[model samples]
Target: MASVREIKRHIKSVSNIKKITKTMQMVAGAKMQKTLSALLASRPYAQLAWNLLLNLAPKTERELHPLLQIRGIRNSLLVVITSDRGLCGAFNMNVIGEALRQIKDKETHFLITVGKKGRDFFIRRGYKVIAEFTGLGAPAPFISITPISQIIIDEFIKGNVDEVKLVYSDYVSNVIQRPTTIQLLPFQQEQPEEPFLAQFIYEPSPSEVIENLLVRIIEYKIYAAILESQASEFSARMMAMKNATENAENLIQSLILSYNKARQEGITKELTELSTTKAVIESLKK
Candidate 1:
C-alpha cells in the first residue's frame, strides 16, 4: 500500500496539470474561433478567384504566360504548411508524412516550408529546402502571404521547378481535420460539374489582364491555404488539450481514492493500537 503522503503529493501534481491543460484548452478554443472567422471571410474571395480563372482559361492561350504552361515534370517544388508549435495530435506528422510520400530520391525536389516544424523536419532528414517562412503571427496578415506566393511564382517562371504542390491539413470541422495536397502551378481550370457560361472583357489586353489576375489568384490561394491550416492547428490543439485535461482529472480522482484508502488503513491501525494499549493498562492495574 502506498503512503497517504505520497498519494496526496500525486493528487496535487495531477491537479496542477489539470489546471494547465484546462487553461490551454480554453486558449486554443478562443484562437480557433478567431481563425475560423478569418477563414470564412476569405472563402468567397478565393472562390471568386477560381471562377475568374475558369472564365479566363478558355479565352487566353496557355503560352501567354509561363504560369499557365504545363511543362513536363522532371523536378518539382512542394510547399508544406504546418503549425510552428505542436501540442496538436498528429497535425504536424500527417502533413510531414504526406510530403514525404511525394518525395522521389532520383528526381530532384525542392521544398518551401511555411512552418518551423515542417522546415525542421525536412532539414533534419537532409532534404533540400529551397525556401522557408516561419513565425507567421496569429491571425496572419494578408501581406505575409505575398512573399511566399512570390517565391513560388518566381520559381515557376524561372523553370526551377516544373510543378508546385501545397501540402496542408484541411479544416473540415471542429472535430475533423484531414491532410490534403493540391497542385498550385500549371494552373488548371476547375470545371463545375454543371455547365455555366461566363464571359469577361479585358481592359488592356487579354495577356496583361491574365498576368495580373493570375498573380492575385495565386496570392489569394496561398492566403486561403494558410488560414485553413491555422484553423486546423487551433482545432487540433484544442482537442489535444481537452483530452489531456480529461486524463489529468481521471488521474487526480484515482490518486484521491488511493489517498483516502491509505488514510483509512492508517486510522484503523491507530485505533487497534489504542484499544490494545487500553486493555494492557487495565490488566496491569488489576
Candidate 2:
C-alpha cells in the first residue's frame, strides 16, 4: 500500500489532467460545428460541378482536353491532406496509412502534401515530397487551394506525371470518417443518369468553354475535398478529446478511491495504536 500523501498527490495530478482534457473536448466540439457547416455548404456546389462535367464531357472528344486524356502510367503525383496538429485520434494516421499502402512499391511517386502532419511524416521517411504546404485553414479557401490544384494540373499537362491522385479523410458523419484516395486527373465521367438535353450556346466555342469549366471543376473538387478533410479532422478531434476526458475522469475517480482507502487505513491504524496506548496508560494509573 502506498502512503496517503503519495495517493493524494496522484489524485490531484489526475484531477488536473481531467480538467485539461475536458476543456479540449469543449473546444473541439465548438470547432466541429463550424466545420460541419462549411462541409455541408460545399457539397451542393461540388455536386453541380460534377454533374456539369458529366454532361459536358460526353459532348466532346477526350483528346481535346488534356485533363480528360487517359495515358499510360509512367509516374504519379499524390496530394495528401492531413491535420496540422494532432490530438485527433487516428485521423492523420488513417490518411497517411492509406496513402502509403496505395503508393507502396511504385516506380516513381511524387508527393504534394498539405498539413504539417503529412509533410513531416513523408519527409522523415525520406520519401519524395515535391511540395509541402502547412497551416491550411479549416474549410480552406478556393483562392488558397487553387495554387495547389494548378501545380498538379501544370505537372500533368507538362507530361511530368501520368496521373494525379488525392488522399484525404472523407467526412461521413460525426461518428464515422473514412480515409480515401481518389484520382484527380485524366477524369472520365459516365453519362448523366438523368436525361437532360444539353441546350446551351458556348461563348467562344464548346471546346474552349469545356476546357475552362474543367479547370474550375478541378479546383473546386480539390477545395471540396479539403473542406471534407477539415470537417473530418474536427469531428475526429472532438471524439478523441471526449474519450480522453471520460477516461481521465474515470482515472481520477479510481485514484480518489485509492487515496480515500489509504487515508482510512492510516486513520484506523493510528486509532488502534491510540486505543492501545490509552489502555496501557489507564492500567498504569490504576
Candidate 3:
C-alpha cells in the first residue's frame, strides 16, 4: 500500500500524461481527416487509370512495351512504405512483416524503403537496401513520390529487377487498417468483358501514347499507395493516443481513490491517539 503522498504524486504524474496524450490524439485526428480526404479523392483516379490499362492491354503487344514485358522472377525489388516516426501500434510492424513474408524464400531481393522505420529495420539485419527515402511528409505529394516510381521503372527497363512489388498499409476506416502487398511492375493484363468493336485513332502515335500512359499509371499507383499509407498511419496514431489517454484517466482515478483512503486512515489513527490521550489524562486528574 502506498502512502497518501506517494499516491498523490502518482495521480499528478498520470494527470500530466493524460493531458499530453489527449493533445496528441487531437492532433492525429486532424491529420487523419486531411489525409483521408486526399486518399478518397485519389482513389477514383487510380481506379480509372487501372481500368484504362486493362482496356488497353488487349490492344498492345507485350514485345512493344517494356513495362508489359513479363520476365522470370529471378530477382525482385520491393518498395516498403512505413512511417518516419512510430508511436502507432503495429502500423510499421505490419508493413515490415508483410514485406518479410513476400521475400522469405526469394534468393535475390533488393529493397527500396520509403520511411526511416523500414530502412532501419532492413539495414540493421543486413538486408540489401538499394534506395531509401525518408520524411516525405504526411499526405505525401504526387511530385515527391515520382522519383521512387521512376527508380523502379528504370530498374525494370534495365533488366536489373525482374519483378517489382509494393508493401503498404491500406486505410479501410478510422478503426481498421490492413497491410497490403501489390505487384507494380510487368503490368498484369486482364481481358475486358466486351470485345472492342469500335476503332479509335491515336493522338500522335500509339507507341508513344501507350509508353507515356504506362509511366503515368505506375507513378500514380505509387502515389496512391503512399496516400493510403499516410492515412492509415494517422488513423493508427490517433487511436493509439486515444487509448493511452483513456488508460491514463483510469489510472488517475484509481490513484485518487487510494489517496483518499490513505488520508482517511491517517485521520482515524490520529483521532484514536487523541482519544486515548484524553482518557488517560482524565483518569490521572481524578
Compare the candidates by lDDT and give the number of the best one: 3
Q: Sort the candidates on lDDT, descending order.
A: 3, 1, 2
User: For candidate 3, lDDT tens digit of each residue in 54-96?
Assistant: 6666667889899989989888999999999988989999999
**lDDT (tens digit, per residue) of candidate 2 on 13-65:** 87788788788878877877877787678779878877777767667898888
- Report the poorest 10 consecutive residues by lDDT, candidate 1: 190-199
lDDT of 1 by residue, 1-286 (tens): 8788888888888889889989999999999899989978888887776766676666777887888889899889999999899899989999998888888762499999999999999989888898999998877889999899999999999999999999998999998998889999988765554455755568897788789999998888788788889999999999999999999988888888888899999999999999999999999999
TM-scores of all candidate predictions against the true structure: 0.93, 0.93, 0.93
Q: Which pairs in model 3 have colliding backbones?
A: none
**Prediction 3 global C-alpha lDDT:** 0.88
lDDT of 3 at 18: 94
- Residue 66 deviation, candidate 1, in Å? 1.0
Sorted on TM-score, best first, the list reads 1, 3, 2
Query: How many pairs of residues collide in each model?
Result: 0, 0, 0
TM match of model 1 to true structure: 0.93
RMSD of each: 2.0, 1.8, 1.8
- Candidate 3 ranges with C-alpha deviation above 4 Å: 51-55, 105-107, 193-198
Task: Give each model's whole-structure lDDT.
Answer: 0.87, 0.86, 0.88
Candidate 2 lDDT at 198 equals: 59
Candidate 1 — which residues are off by over 4 angstroms?
190-201
